[model samples]
Target: MSGTVSDYLLYRLNQWGVRRLYGYPGDGINGILGALGRNSEFQFIQARHEEMAAFMACAHAKFTGEPGVCLATSGPGAIHLLNGLYDAKLDHQPVVAIVGQQKSMGLGGHYQQEVDLPVLFKDVASEYTVMVSHPSAIRHAVDRALRIARAERTVTCIIIPNDVQESPYQRPPQVHGSIHSSVGYSEPRVVPKEQDLRRAAQVLNEGKKVAMLVGAGALNAADEIIEVADLLGAGVAKALLGKAVLPDELPFVTGSIGLLGTKPSWDMMMGCDTLLMVGTSFPYSEFLPPEGLARGVQIDLDGRMLAIRYPMEVPLTGDSQETLRALIPLLKRKEDRSWRDSIEKNVRQWWKVAEGQAMKEANPINPQRVVWELSPKLPDGVILAADSGSAANWFARDLKIRKGMMASLSGNLATMGCGVPYAIGAKFAYPERPVIALVGDGAMQMNGNAELVTVAKYWKEWKDPRFIILVLNNRDLNMVTWEQRVLAGDPKFPASQDLPDFPYARYAESIGLRGIRVDKPEQIARAWDEALSANRPVVLEAYVDPDVPPLPPHITLEQAKHFAEALFKGDEKAAGVVSQSIKAMVEQLKPHKS
Candidate 1:
């Protein structure tokens, strides 16, 4: 009970069920690092950068649904954690960020490595931000940060001055005696009243066609969602964040929405007369049914998010499961299957088109084929993390999340460089499960590739060293190049968009892990097999075609015109993209001879 404040803080973290702390050690945090060295309950994961530490923490919380913990030093170190912290905050994941500060005497003197962290972190960790100035206040501050992080599902910051961390415990016994941390926020289920349920049910019953749009908040209520979908005869469309909420193979479920979504999802949303938005705050209003076109009923646990995206006639504020259970009985089962059947037909056709796209062979391997091949090969209960950009497009469209598998990306923040760190965190949380990071060449070089060393360092500690990094080595910022062609009628800017090639496989091998490079399409499966079979961390670098366009399910005339303009302007890759698009359209338009 009597130890340095650093010891007390670590003890409280352990008590709160944080077994691993991801961080980069710095001079300002020497006291805490020394305490960590002496402690066995908590393991310190040394990340190459403070940003990766924070990203790993965010990914841990995303995978485990527990408050993830990270640490960093003063000034630049603390600032480095912001992007990752914002990822946790925007995605509504719980995270506790502990930062070290300069000595107490350097408060406003502009000393080295000194920044006013409390004020700086205010916007990001709006839930709670405290600087522990007193040895006696350590327990209370740590407890409050943890509790608020859990309850609010947001980031919390705890700033500790170096001197305070090393200070001996001089507080009275009563201060420590009063502090008790609960497992989590124990709030009663917020189910809607019968009247609200009846009203929501009435709205759904009145419409001839209803579509259900779900998000991550409905993750635990998949069965209930199915029941509601079955009763209302509604086709379900998932937000990108909710891709894993329901199995992609479900007949009535129309994959993801927005630019990354399937044709069926877009069609269903556009055609529905009534929309039942469950546990989602999907920000793109244009992708959703127009305000006047469809009557909406939104159900969300947080009242603040209700009706934030679309116009809702009925807003049901409660837990997704509890509210759905209450409203299910009140909903009238639509006897007509016409609406659902049409959506199913579209879904079926879309999959065929998608498969064709994934299988198309180019001079260099098509990127989609990589995901398509990886999908069936993935073992059950696998954890997959995707980086933003072209890699994410492949993951969103091609990867299938079976019942037991978990997949995550920087959904709300939509940031890059999270893929490797997220995979590392998932591996740490479930060492027995196979973890894979699907990263683009640009993203890998940006910040993800460095984490390979961290994985190498921790490989020996894992029960199963099945951490695989699938690098789509396309040698260009392919997504941005495609966007320029399709959105701005501009050709690829070689200087800005092109990336110098790096030997990712060799890099992995140099770090004492398995590395396989695939240049031909036929070698992709073999490379994946080798990587998966390896007993340690492995990198499978597939050199994909930079010319293949990541086309959306449906293409607009304007987009086509932009591509044509780019082609006319001497963009060498434009002709190939147009040919690909025309081929896909022809396939889609062709009749099923069956």
Candidate 2:
């Protein structure tokens, strides 16, 4: 049988090396669905919701460094993809979204599912988006979407009308007006100019104290970064997206930066005389060296993102790995070891403080302890995904990323309900590796619970069925509650902040997966051990105390004032908040030495 345009679209995707698709089926995509039925080659992962599918696609891109493809029906299905697509856009991952629209003739008549998808997707898929109005258009549309998405490392869209999808496939005619497009893209080796590398090295070489900050863009450049850091005698700080860029075992590698950052990272940024930011546009300018205090040199693929956060003396626009490799020869190894020694000391002290905070007693369970205990238990080559909210705070600060592990979250978009989907996507990419999702109860309720069913359906097929979802089952919007006190000086509004309790572990048990529930602190480690050894996927729910605040590395005067004001304003948990805040603060000084 002659293939339809829908079949041709799948063929084009296969040619582009797309082996799997993450999406939910809908009536509007009936033609594509039929084509999928005919083709048995592609792995179509059916997520419970369209949004989860998009997140899965984004995660696939992040983990595999390939352009993730997602499918959706028009209108609402398309609308649901916005949040996850925005996540990929802000984080700069390549993703291609294929959408099904209403009949072409019905677009202007306000027919059902007739959305102006191009307009709807303009911002998210700003690199390229097109509606295939003709059968010949499908070829160019699919080709362009994949190419543009790969080249730009951004989202691109192709909207196919149902009628056009069902139409007989046609190659573009060999005429002047007809367009021809092809598959396959290879990244170019991009290195900064020799003069630019030397100029940047001169600034770095002249400094007495240097600090290095890296992000997701530096994930592939870890070796180069380590060499540079060693030569400069500098401390390295990781932006959240780059948590796994360098292992925490390095003496000079300070953990995450920004609000959820470690004290060592904050201290290194503040005290450094020179800053070398590689492949990271860490947004918190306040957390960086105060403007003119430190001379900066930044390396980024896009020149536009180079010096927006700090005033870089030299901005090298090139690939992080290639640029650093070139810049290495120009860099002189610093003779002074005092700066490096101080940084290592600080790193050691900060780890102790983290232990103190984690071990501090809470009402039932400390959220920090849950992740801290699991950090050492994490399998080699494990992949981690963390949801937004307090779980992210704990994941960022408590978990120690090893050399081979990979971890990511909704970094720029910081959306909830991404942890489960991202973990699922990671498992799909590397079924042999263990995968874990750290989720807050709010996020678990939002969408994680539903995705558990998806996990239950697919876990048996994975090469190593060791997937774990560790839910911090605190019955409150813990992050926002603390934010209200520390940022807005407002009391926790129970009507908005409080959450209904649900049996997450029991629910997992009901779905034929291992379930572990822990309220006592002593059970945290045992629960993690049991979940990791489980034959099937497991849900480990830790009922943590919401009052144990996720304190910032350094508290500001304004934040302190706000905290006092919130307490004065009759916050119901004022005593607990005050007590916990003091305990966390005291841990900074009384770090439990090993």
Clashes of each: 0, 0
lDDT of 2 by residue, 16-75 (tens): 999899998888898999999988999999999989999999999999999999999888
Please list the residue runs of candidate 1 whose C-alpha ends up more than 4 Å from where it truly belongs after superposition: 172-184, 592-594
Model 2 lowest lDDT segment of ten: 585-594
Give the runs in model 2 whose Cα sits over 4 Å from its true position: 591-594
Residue 446, model 2: lDDT of 97
Model 2, residue 527: displacement in angstroms?
A: 0.7
Write model 1 residue lDDT over 326-354, tens digit each, in one string: 98888888999999889888888777777
lDDT of 1: 0.88
Candidate 2: pairs in clash: none
